[model samples]
Target: MKKHIIPTIAFALFTTSAYGQSMQVGFSNVTTVVPGGDIKICKARYGTGYVTSPHKNGAKIHKSSDKGHFIHITKSNVTLHHDVYVMANEYNMSYPGDKGEITAKAYVYATALDRKSGFSGVFSDGQCKGQLTISAK
Candidate 1:
């Protein structure tokens, strides 16, 4: 128990410190899934800086929205891998007869499955906060 506790504390401290760097990550505009050009963040569990959710869309007038995979567990699904953020829109864009203006977004595809990515950002984009994508060159 002593050994485990020591390591856990160290690990927590390390992650907390790493968030200060402010790394930038990018994700391809969700080729696979993105309801209403967004992803709903129904649930999020991570460190103080990170956040995730499953329900990315829906409303009272609409009653309900389509459901996506429940990514509560890390090993259960690959989609639930990196941190996930679902999204949607409240207002519609004014256009000349059916102009395609997709302001609504479902799920902000944040990589690394960490808390800092969703909880913090350079600016205010809400769920689509934090690094866009990061990878080895």
Candidate 2:
């Protein structure tokens, strides 16, 4: 009986550790326009990895019933903010014909469902640059 109980407890602990807890994060209020004029907001981490679908501007927030998908904004775009524009232009001016690409970082307010187990703050992405990292936490 003792041997069987010990094995059962050990199995339970192992299983629990093997499958980490799921996390959900949501963001709102902020909006951004893509290069082609499409608007986007960000939502990160519903389950494990990133998930994306083409959505219209001002569309309702999407929630996945499935357990392993999350949503995030993609396709970095240039911003029209005056300060950012000036800075980017200055950087570009260093190149011939002032034709260098501009890169800017944008931040979004975020909240995570996990308490004391993960992070909750402003998430950032580099616009007009390469791939962005959206972690599941």
Candidate 3:
């Protein structure tokens, strides 16, 4: 009994410490230019897995008459060796029958950290964002 108890306790301690230090955290965002586009966003959190409802933390669309339109997404507490994807779309329209020929753009910002290092960056336009084929005259 004594021998079994000692081994069990040691195993528990080892696992606890290993998991405590093995997690990495990260954030990334990707945007697409439209009429129509596809956006893929990936974020990683080491050691500890992503929290439930990652997007619940913060995700939204912003529109302005002068600034146009944009989408903002944020995730927190992600798991290690795991990738999370987010999809979002945004658009705007001007006066009716005005032939809205305006150009659309997207932007993304993220912050992440790992057991070894940290990653924080921003992407815009044709950088990290993907452009969709828009049919217009």
Per-residue lDDT tens digits of candidate 3, residues 1-137?
Answer: 11112232242233231111221222233343343454331111111112112122232222222212122222122222233212122223221223444333433333223322233344344423422211111
Model 1 misplaced regions, further than 4 Å: 1-18, 32-137
Candidate 2 off by > 4 Å:
1-19, 33-37, 41-118, 127-137
Candidate 2's TM-score reads: 0.24
Tell me the deviation in Å of residue 71 in model 3: 3.9
Candidate 3 positional error at 112, Å = 1.2
Report lDDT per candidate.
0.25, 0.26, 0.26
What TM-score would every model get versus the actual structure?
0.19, 0.24, 0.20
Worst 10 residues of 1 by lDDT: 69-78
Off by over 4 Å in 3: 1-60, 63-102, 107-109, 114-119, 127-137
Write the residue-wise lDDT of candidate 2 on 2-26 in tens digits.
Answer: 1112232242233231113223333
Ranking by TM-score: 2, 3, 1
Alpha carbon deviation, residue 117, candidate 2 (Å): 8.2
Superior candidate under lDDT, 1 versus 3: 3
